[model samples]
Every structure is written in structure tokens, then in C-alpha cells.
Target: MLDHLITHDDNLRMVPTDRNELAAAVGHLQEELRALPEGSDTARARVLTRWIGIAQLCLGHHDEARTSLRQSLELAVTIGNSRAVVATGLNLGDAHRYAGDVRGADALYRSALITARYHHPELMDFALQHTGKHLMECGDPAGARAHLQEALRLRIAKGDAELVKSTQAALERVELLISQADASATGHAVPGQWSRQWTAWLQSRITTRTPSRWAQDFPTVRYAVAGLTAHQRVHPCHLRDQSFPSALLTAMAEEAEKAVAADGYLHNGKWNAATLDAVSLFVGQVDLADVVSRSSGLAVEPPHTAVYIAYEEGQRLDFHLDEFGFGEANLILCLKHERPAELPRASTTVFLTADSYLECDLAAGDCIVFDGALTPHGRTPLSAGESVTLVCFGFRAREQDSRTVTHLPPVPSGRAALGRPESAPAPRCATLCGHAGN
Candidate 1:
């Protein structure tokens, strides 16, 4: 019933009703118990162990609590203390009940009941009440009723109005269920016994034609689509927090560094450099492409691919998209520059005509993609320094019409095409049809 404030900030609070939260609380309390000095005080240990056992029971961590409380109970017995032993036994029984071990709970309750009779009558009453609950679970309602009724009488005699009221509510529900079951066993008919009458009555509640809004309001479920749409355009500047595998960037950088040093100069369009070789790992992580595609809404097209490599300072791209005709998305992966570069401030700028231009100054693993249709986009001139490299993948539909030309030539007959009039373009129809007049 206790609501704990999990955080020290005074605002973060949680209830123990949630299973995960209760389990976490048990873990926290265990840590606190472990911090206590060994043998500091047996009474204090007993108190902490009791609460810990209860927390574990609520969390459904029964075996863990049983182990903890059994040890504490053994210590209490060695000290000739009945109070702690009796309390721990009652808690152990509770844990057994929660784990659906009715017989084990009954044995523990019986032991606690004997100790409670001599040491504390209140605890004896508690044990009896729980024993009755176990009896009910074990399918002995008569025995359960006897124990529960006696427990209820004891509580009333002790003048505990709260316990009496609670016990009375339980007794009433048991009696009501028993009576209804007895009545149902006789030759009397229940409301739904007449099958034909019941079916007609239920059918009257239904309708052949329901409201159309019901169909719209309750939509059918659909699986997740791992692609992007070009219709929902996104700016290239939005991918500031994209995370990439670290090993990938290191391998790519090492590859690129090896290439430039070996040849005295790096060549364009050839990924043979050490950097490009390391790009395969990034490409292997298909989920990253799905994330980018969804964010950018690039049309689901052929060649779902991505490339990433590290770019040291002084590297530059002249401006080009992949060989794929339609440029859907370009992702740039960048790493932070440790120091400034030698040639002009190292920033990649895409020149989209004179009026509209875009510049990207990226940190490590940052990615962005844009539709090539929106003014030509490219990076700025690179200087000699640490800059980020990106593997850009362009996607297109799996299948596309091979015809490159948009316009069609005049037909030889000039007759109406199949399913189209002669006035319409030949491309609109698959083929032409001959008419006698032609």
C-alpha cells in the first residue's frame, strides 16, 4: 500500500501495484540490507528482513524471499525469541500462497499458529485466517468455514471492529456462492436454458446493417512498413542525432588513410581505399536504412543500399549522385573534428543554384538525406583536417519501366490505338489497332 518516491528529486513517485516496480523495489531494499554491518542488532535485522520478505512476495519473487526470511527466522530461534520466529513463519506462508503452493503454505501456517497461541493471540488469529484461505484453495470449504468463523469470533471478542468487518464480508460471499450452487443443482431451469428463446432474444440486440462510422472508428491492424515516401518531404538538416557503430568509422578511416599514403593521392569514384572497405559493416545494418527511409519518406524503390566511410581533413566530393537515375536519398555520416583544418573552414556546402544553397557541418555518425530533385545538392570544398565521411545509398522501386523517353513518336497508321483515340499519344496505349477506314 506504500507509495515510494523512487527518485531523490521529490517529484518522481511510483506505486507498488505495478509488477516491474515492485520487483525493482525488492532489489533496492536488498542493497540497503547488504550495507548494514553484520550482527549490528538482531532485532533490527529481523525488522528489515520481514519487510524485505513482504516486498519480495508482492513482486512474485517468492524463492528469494523464502531464502532470506528462513535465515533470519533461524537466527531469531537461536536467540530464544518467539516473536520474530512467528512473524517470519507467517510471512513465509504468504510467499508460499503467492507461488500457488497451498500445501507448503498450510504447513508454515500451522507452525506459526502453534507459536502464536502461546506467544501472541493476535498473530494466532492471523495464522488461522490465512489457514482458512489455504483450505478454500485446497477445496475444503467446510473446513475453511470452520476456521474462518472461529477466527472471526476471536477478532470480535478482542473488540477489533475492523478485522470483524473484513471477516464478515468474506463469510457473506462464501455463503452466497454455496447457496447459488445448491439451487443450480436442482431440477429448476435457469434463464438461458431455453436455447431457441435465448438465441432469438440475443439476435434482437444485433442488426444486419451497422453504422459506417464503426468501420472507420475501429481500424484493422497492419504490420510495420520499413520504407519511406517521397510525398512527405524532409529537409536534409534534420538528421543531427543519427548513431552509427564506432568500429565502422575507425575501419573506414584506417582504410582511407592507407589509400592516400600508398598512392600519394586518393582517387575519386573508387572505394578501394581502406575507408571504403570498412563501409560494408555499415551497409550490413539494414535497420539503419529502414530508419532513414521512414524518416525521409523516400519512395520504396529498387536498390536499398547505404555506404559510410571516414573522411579525414582535405577530402572533397566534386558533386555526384549514385549511377541510379532517380536520386531518392543521400546520407552523410560525420565525425567530430579534433582540431581545425588547414584549407578554408572545413564545411561541406551543396550548391543548389545561386538562390538556394545548403551547407552541412557534421559531427561523427551524423546522417542526412534529401531528394535530388530539390536544386542540385553537394558538399563544400574540404581542407586538410578531420572531417566526417558518409556512405550514401540511393533507393529506387524494385521494378520500373525501362523506357527513358517521356514522349512517344507518331504512329505509322495514325489510327486509333487500342483502348485510345488517335488524338491521344501512342505512349498512352500499349499498341495500335487498325480500322478499315485507315
Candidate 2:
């Protein structure tokens, strides 16, 4: 009869996110555990207790979560339920980490990661994600990125949007931390930047005179501090020193075309793929972003404002500075270029300098990294049947990211510029064309 009651209790294995719902569930489970005879059904009790512990963890009761999960973990080990043990270990590790026991958290996450790899590959991302977070918190940005990226790939393959989002958020937070650290190292660090916690870490790290294992243990942070130069604001750096992975670029171009076509853009403007959650999630990967940020000296956010930009016949841009929020540092990577004449040169010209109008013809895979806010640039009117497709990645200055939820930058008015025929109406864009009053 007692086994029957505990068996029925197994059906209450829901992990609710609501605080009130979680609290009620925790309380109910506790009551049930007290009612049960000691050692009546260890298996069922472990299952129930695991849920209770995780529920308490979600409820922000870290101490309680640790106690319950530790107890449940022992039961799982005793009963030989390795999977449950792995699962409970993850939550318990999170509890430890959150409660300021860094070493405890590190141990559990490492253990869980290894166990999940062999026993339950399905939960590998869960373990990997938490481990990555732990690594970042411990000041190892590169290791954190590597782990998070792998975890993201797995979560994406698993087709769980929520799980993917969780990993992505952690990855982004880690990326931002590296960028901020890079900025500080280059003597261009923004005073009082985003993330108080990250700022605090940097403050202590920068002043440490005694040679810590900085180069060996936290090489990513070290590289960000040593390998980069203060980024140039006026003259654009071609980044000829580094090679973008061709395979990734190929995949990105293919994905960009499909995404832009499906989500059509303004006739001669842009399609903001950053708004497309899935496409944005895939193309703007951590590998490309990390390189760009280190080279550019700006703490790049996930290219959430990334766009598919284009201009058709008769489209021209007057030289103008881009506004700050969306595009302070801009990466213009040409994806595709087509023209009626099979000219060996690029049909469209980018004026690197507005005063002198220095023209540069860019080809596919040629990326130009420049400060859009400080550099005056424009596109010349395209000849007949000429179209240029570009993928633009933009990041705001780190200190400038103090946007309130409602304080969004005004949308780039998708309007035709000065050269548009007066008879024709301004083309509306699925994205921001970025050429307005110029």
C-alpha cells in the first residue's frame, strides 16, 4: 500500500517555473516525504526528492536546494540510478555555485559533465551549459566560450528553443565580459560599463600586480588584454592579418540569402536578420564574433541588429555618419555582387572618405571593419541592373549600452535617399537601409 502511494507520487515530477507553483509543489512533496515510512521506497522517494530539490532551486532557496538535492543524490547513487544522479548533481552544483561555493560548484559541474558524456549524452548540453557558466564566473572566458558554443550546438540540434535561449543568454553574457575586459586592457576601457559584477571582476583583475596564472589559466582574458591595440576610429582596418574561416562564411552567406528572401526587405534598403531569432541565432556565431571583437576593440553584443542590406539601380548614398546605438563599429562583409557588365571590378563603390570620395570596389568575402559613427562613408548610384547584397554586423560602444526596455533607438526610417526619383515613393524596408538625410 505504501509502495502504491509512492508510485502514484512519481507522477508529480513536473518542474514548474512559477515561484508560487514551485513553492506549493515543494511543500506538498515535503509533506509526502514526512508521511512515508522510512526506507519504504527509496527509488520513488529519490524521484520525488529530486523534483523537490530542483523546485526549491528554481524558487531561489539555494541552501534548501542543496540540502534536498544532496540527500536525493545519495539515494540515486545507492539505488544505482546513474541518470538521476547526474541530473540531481547538476542542480546541486548550481545551488553550490549560486551560494558562493565556487570550488564545490566546479567539482560538481566537472563530475556531471564527465558522467553525462558517457552515461547520458542527451543531458550533455545541460551539464555543459552550467559548466561553461562556471568557467566564465571563474575568469576563463575562452574556455567558457568553447564549452558554451558546443552546448549551444547540441541544444539547437535537440530543437528545444527554451534550452537554446538559456545557453545563448549565458554565452552572450560571457562574450560581453571578454569584450569589456579587452576594452580595459587596451587603455580604452569605458568607465562604469554594463554589468556591475563584470566591472567588479575587471577592477580587481586590472590592479593585480603579482603575476597570477593570467597567461596560462585565463589566456582568453590575457589575450584580450595583451594581443589587441587601441582600435582606430577614423581609418578602417581591413583585418588583413586574420583569416575568416571560409567554411563558416560560406554557410553564413547561404543562410543569409535564404533568410532575407523569406523575410523580404525594402527594395533598396536592408532586412534586419537580427530580428529573425532563428537566422540571427545561427549566422552570428560565437567564433566569428569573438575574432571580430578582439580585433575591433569593441565589446560586441551578439549581432542582434545584424542585417541583410542591399541597393538596386539608381540607389546612391550621400556621405554621412551612422548614428551611435545600432552602428558605432560596423563590419561590412560583401555577400554577393551582380552587374550587367561582366566588369572585373565591383560595380558599386564605397566612398571611404566623403570629402575626397575615395572609392573602393569590394568583392565577395572581403570584409571592411570601420567605425561608422566617426567615418563618413556612402555608396554611389548603381548603374542599370546592378545589385549588391551585403551582410552588416554592428555593435554599439560598451558604455553606450544603457538602454531601457522601452528606450529603443528610433528605427532607421526605410526611406529613399536624395538620389531617388521624385516620381517614385521612398522604398519601405523589412530592415533599416541606414541612408536617410545624407
- Which candidate's TM-score is highest? 2
Indicate which candidate wins on lDDT. 2
lDDT of 1: 0.49
Candidate 2: tens digits of C-alpha lDDT, residues 81-191 = 899878889878878877789999999998998798667867888888888888887898656765776677566555679788877787768768866876545443221
lDDT per residue for candidate 1 within 336-423, as digits (tens), equals 3444644445545342222122445555555555543222344444455545544455444322332111121111121122123335
lDDT of 2 at 395: 56
lDDT of 1 at 263: 33
Q: Candidate 1 regions off by >4 Å?
A: 1-24, 186-438
> What are the lDDT scores of the predictions, listed in order?
0.49, 0.57
Model 1 CA lDDT for position 8 = 14
